[model samples]
Target: MKPAAHVRKTALPGVGTRYDLNTEAGAHLSVVVHQDGRRIISFHDPEDDDACKDAAALAPAEATALSALLTPDPVAHLHQHLEIDLVTEHIPIGRRSPYAGRTLGATQARTRTGASIVAVLRRTDAFPSPTPDFRLALGDTLVVVGTREGADAVAELINGG
Candidate 1:
């Protein structure tokens, strides 16, 4: 899982300081701050993304300003008006099935709390976008997506508790 993007620090006129970050898509970022508060952030990707450019263009003042904008409070406000869809579904597991003995199936089933199960997991493998007839086995895991509550319910059902 990728760490959420955040502002780390604002150093005073410093000796060279650097911070390393990993992006969501598995990329590395190296940022160096100079004594004068100038920053040089480099991205490891061969093809530059807009984030890299934006980071590079950020001066200390701009970085601080951007940091404020990215803060949790302000970001939360921005999302206050956005609507998120909530969906839920139950997947049946067969008795004496391959997935019946394992928690993998239960854990996967929990993921359906507020979402739809678009597939299944069977013995260390995933059935991406499984067909409706994909019979769930004792060890088979359910692939679910929905709101948090729906996912939790599915998980509980799968656990048989």
Candidate 2:
């Protein structure tokens, strides 16, 4: 089981408030709400409670951008999560997506499109190279592998466009 996030908010007397977050993955983030309407961010040691992990003190906008940059987008995370080969597209399974609620075998996905649905991301878990008999679900992110044209064909095949 994964550890839950631990956060603490404290009033820093005349300075302002301090918000500290201990993330599930052992990351530590601290933000100081200064009385001057500025925030001082700090990176604390995930292992050592007293020592800092790295560095940073940024304005709100800078803080946001830093956070955004640190956070990986869905596709980027998928690439990191999977053992990829050839080209791959993270195709979202929407309601109108033809593969939704359908069996992979029924779609003849491999036989027709030449794009292999090597993995499916459903919520938090990833199903890699799922069986042909496995049924696809709505909101699943299908990891397809092939050439650009083949990927496009697979997308078109599923979207019925």
Candidate 3:
């Protein structure tokens, strides 16, 4: 049988219910369901319990969309609960994108922006764990993960900064 996860439930008077989960990897995550249908998700710093490394306040629809992304793939769900304060974003390669016809390695996105391109979505096809040699094309959407700032920097770099 699979091991059970450690979680704590807290009630905030007039605010909402908060669920704190401690992952097996030693990462901390918190989800607050507000009284007004908003959801706040946050990742805490492992070294400092009082510090929040990353957080996002999501509307009901946005929460649903996030749920959809995490539901089908167990790996994706697991990564979401990991200790890293990283976020996943889909960044599109536009017509003016400098890296459209270049190899992924040529962009050096990870080295330059600290974000890693995990996959690519081109038309109806999905390429998971794309190699550095992968050739990018216009309209292709890059699936990247890192700090929010890192992801944004990647988008900026891909668009010629």
Candidate 4:
């Protein structure tokens, strides 16, 4: 069995958390996850611990793509090729939303915005492929699958446009 590499985690006050790891090849690498969901990957110079040889900043979406590439999950590989054009978003129904007490059919999300509500997350329970008659509630998170624009439209519509 291959031994697990030890990763050191450091807290950067007022900045973010950093995870440092030494590769089997003796290279130093670190990844920082910021408060706003941004990520920075850095390769350190062996001679100078504080010096960075190269660095790359990645947005949340870019980081997700990079993570998928490095993951061994079979399901993750299936959607890698379709990452560019397809987008999956989770939209929350707020307390002030007009559809909070209404049925899913009222939104007409798929017809009007072209986004499909594949699931609804209510507390710890998940309702998959919810029917149009499914009632919406505050704090329910809608799992939507569609283009970016379509997801944005769904958010706007659910929040009373």
Candidate 5:
């Protein structure tokens, strides 16, 4: 059985840091930060409670102070919730990409998207369980198991969008 895909942690200078995040609902997050001492934190909903609370708990003075310390840019949080639906939404991708090249690992992929690729499709053929080495080619469709937006992103990547 293949593992899952998720966001891994990476280091960034000037900006706080970068991390590959996977939402519990299944989605991919590619985060970046600016050199203005600003930090971009992206993660799953369940994992972001503390940060949310911290932000919510900030008083006017505290907010101003924190804003002064950090960049003035608005914090971007991507998630599928009833209140704030920034992105398209979660779309399930049936399985992993059959043709693979520099594709994310199973564990990493799952961590980010919450869906597993149970099968792979190559041309008119289908692979029930694809190995890690499977190289993805252009025009090769991937049946990912994620949210609608996640599926769209995968499709875009495959279609060179």
Candidate 6:
């Protein structure tokens, strides 16, 4: 029988698992998955086929960020979305806005907007993780996080719409 034409999988004690495969061009590639949701990808040093030189190691979040690169070129898809966009936006408060003179609690931002106000930026001051009791001001800019639709809801809630 010819050499097994499949990637080899090995268990890494106290760590996680490892998978290795040789490309048709004879280059060896390996990926190690750690129990902590981290991954290390490597390529064998061509000069020494017996040894692998780590190419990159990524934490779970970093890997997810890297996966975003796999999507189609963004500039080409500008009018069209390549993926669901979860974004952070800074929304300013106006004097007549409901959030202007009230505490965050009274607004029930999360309950009404389905978005999170993570922080607020006032003139020369920034409040992170502002509590529900924190009072809002006319010039305070809320740093919100959520999908576009959710953010729209938050804008409407702030403006009493």
- lDDT tens per residue, model 4, 56-82: 999875686688577676466678666
What is residue 63's positional error in candidate 2, in angstroms?
17
What residue runs in model 1 are displaced by over 4 Å at the alpha carbon? Answer: 1-114
What is the C-alpha lDDT profile of model 5 across 1-161, one tens digit per residue?
A: 34565657667765645656565665545444445434444433454533422212333333334555655334444232356423322222323533245453532444545545555655456666556666544434345665666655555544434
Query: Runs in model 2 with CA error above 4 Å?
Result: 1-85
Q: Using Cα atoms with residue i matched to residue i, what is each candidate's TM-score against the true structure?
A: 0.32, 0.49, 0.50, 0.53, 0.30, 0.48
lDDT (tens digit, per residue) of candidate 3 on 1-161: 37777789999899999999888899999999999989999999988866999999998757866886766555766886688888888888998898999999999999999999999988768999999899999988899999999999999999988
For each candidate, what is the lDDT?
Answer: 0.59, 0.78, 0.89, 0.89, 0.47, 0.82
The global Cα lDDT (0 to 1) of model 4 is 0.89
Candidate 6, 1-161: lDDT as tens digits: 34655889999999999988787897888878999888988899766856877679987645655665655554665646557577677777877697788898988888877899999988668999999999999978888999898888888888778
Which residue pairs collide, candidate 6?
A: none
| Residue-by-residue lDDT tens digits, candidate 2, 112-144 | 988888998886688998998989888777789
Query: What's the true lDDT of residue 146 in model 5?
Result: 59
Could you tell me which 10 consecutive residues in candidate 2 have the lowest summed lDDT? 59-68
lDDT of 6: 0.82
lDDT, residue 139, model 5: 36
